[model samples]
Target: MIVRIMGEGQVELDDAHLAELNTLDDELLTAVESGDEEGFRRTLGALLDGVRRLGRPLPDATLEPSGLILPAADATLDEVRKMLHDDGLIPG
Candidate 1:
């Protein structure tokens, strides 16, 4: 899967990481819904870190369509809230 971290470019994540990503996405959704700024930041970092750790970074010029688009590391809670969908930022 091609996962894009906005402002950071994209990474090619394996399908095996989908389940783990979904778990983190769920946690992030919970934090966002509860208005827990700390949890939101924590989970968001975890999610992005997971992608960076588990996936290979695509070259900057590789402009493939993103399967999952995550907010930037410095994104505000309100900013991330707008990016969420019914299935959260990551789809199962």
Candidate 2:
């Protein structure tokens, strides 16, 4: 899955890659918890190399609103909820 963080960056990862990285992360954390410096260093080195190869840094950017005005603070919760629900803006 490729997760794109608007105005932040993105990560493209396959299932196998994700699983491996998760395992590596877990191992590194475990080593850190156990005070195993050597193990932690090895796992961290691999993780950094993988990131250097697969990750591309995004250009700095800002997120500008789409010119949509939000409801006033004085608006009641129920009224705002109804507007969002009727507009199909809320998740079911």
Candidate 3:
């Protein structure tokens, strides 16, 4: 799988790594939904450690701007369309 970070470069992950990442994401989300703080923390920590060992930076931990200027949500549809087309993303 090719994982692309907005500001950072993309990563190519093999099947095994992708599966582990999916399992970790599922476990973390399950823990959150069940209100299991300890489980969530443990699972998150393990996920971080595992990804760190893979030598790639962790995903964005916050929603801060990536220094790339993006169109505002209220922009006209045509404007948004142009931006998406320029960015190689298409509305589905």
In model 3, residue pairs whose N, Cα or C atoms come closer than 3 Å (at least 3 residues apart or on different chains), thus clashing, are: none
lDDT of 2 by residue, 16-63 (tens): 455555555566555555657677567655644453345444334633
User: Against the true structure, candidate 2 has what lDDT?
Assistant: 0.43
**Per-prediction CA RMSD (Å):** 0.7, 15.7, 12.6
| Per-model TM values vs. the true structure | 0.96, 0.44, 0.45
Candidate number with greatest lDDT = 1
Cα error, candidate 1, residue 8 (Å): 0.6
lDDT of 3 by residue, 36-82 (tens): 76776676566545544553443555343332222332333344334
User: Any runs in candidate 2 off by more than 4 Å, and if so which?
Assistant: 1-16, 60-92
**True-vs-predicted CA distance for residue 14, candidate 2, Å:** 6.2
What is the total number of backbone clashes in candidate 3? 0
Error of 1 at 26 (Å): 0.5
Clashing pairs in 1: none
lDDT of 3 at 75: 35
Error of 3 at 84 (Å): 23
For candidate 3, the 10 contiguous residues with the lowest summed lDDT are 83-92
Please tell me which predicted candidate would have the highest TM-score against the true structure.
1
Local distance difference test, each candidate: 0.94, 0.43, 0.46
